[model samples]
Target: MLKMFISGSIANNTIPDEVIKSVDVSMDKNYVILVGDAKGVDKNIQDLLKINNYSNVNIYHIGNKPRNLADKNWKQFKVIIDESNPKLFKDGKFTRSAQMIKDKRMVSEADFGLVIWQDVSTNRFGNVQVSKGSLNNIYNLLKMGKPVGLYFVPKPDEGIIKLTDLTYFENGVISNMVNVKTKQYYYEMKSEYEKVETQKKHDKKSQGEQLKFF
Candidate 1:
């Protein structure tokens, strides 16, 4: 079975309950591992899953500081984690680099990844952009041959781009582009990945059968 990894900025309300529902229906029986920075939409997604009785999902909180953690109103977050047996990597007390290392570890362990992020307009880290780290992580995962599905929510004022107007790529190179809406494009990309994965499994099974005869 394919394992899915979900990543996004919880501080921004980009991840919606609808997105979670869509993923649940699309994934069917696949295991979902959610990795997030412990903030706004991240908590929202978790809460929605709990309300919907999704007991098999695993959530990892990668926040390193109290400020980065979920707020007190969401104290149930811990209870949910405990009940779900989700892994907690609370290195927030450590350095930013440490948190980043944990993030990479989670990404490496996942078969596929979904990233939701918005491009930063200002230089928050001197000359560096805010979402730069996230972008780099996504790029690295693609370079390692992991299928990545990216969902970008354009700024509210910016008109939504049709799926046909967008381009997607792996490892900084354009793999394909579509003129449809974002969600439709996601479905198409996911279907293609599933087809490829199915072929890989078949090939592996064939190899195993050949070895058994030897």
Candidate 2:
């Protein structure tokens, strides 16, 4: 069984549905964990999960008042809080700082971490700042030998950009790729190379075409 924890700026909605779809198709059984915040409980993710038959998904909303607790979408799993964090509940909702803290805690508890965020120079509501905090937590997880997968969705795009564009680790250094288009091209070429190699191993060519490579 493979356990994955999801944390990101909920407003982005970049990776949740795509992550879940990937997990469903993978060889391992998945336990999808979500750190719920005010913006995390969107209809897109809920409907996608229900339609895809994700029976092993679990969500942990770190708020005290619990706004979407009784919703049918959440009825599939058990929702719990850390219980030790007393500052989470305030003014009938969870504070932004508390939500970020909870996101870190959830990242620490999983086997692997997945983050979805955007790269914007200016954040109007300051919510995008949480992505940096979440990325820092993910960097720590990578230090502990955990594989942290990151996906970024650029503004005005509906699909998830490649993970390699937003994540990398080398020579004890971690960084995010700044050029999205270039990173995507790198991955695409790499994949094509792998496919050619696999085909070559099983291909038996005729004598006339022996000098030519596929």
User: Candidate 2 regions off by >4 Å?
Assistant: 14-21, 26-28, 40-43, 65-93, 121-130, 155-214
Q: In model 2, what lDDT does residue 84 have? A: 54
Give candidate 1's root-mean-square deviation (CA, Å): 11.1
After TM-score superposition, the amount by which residue 180's alpha carbon in candidate 1 deviates from its true location, in angstroms, is: 25
Q: For each candidate, what is the lDDT?
A: 0.51, 0.50
Report the number of backbone clashes for model 1: 9
Q: Which candidate leads in TM-score?
A: 2
Task: Report the alpha-carbon TM-score of model 2 versus the true structure.
Answer: 0.54
Pairs of colliding residues, candidate 2: none
The digit string of per-residue lDDT tens for model 2 on 70-172 reads 2445423223444455576565655555655655566666777665655333468553232444445455566556776655554324344333222344211
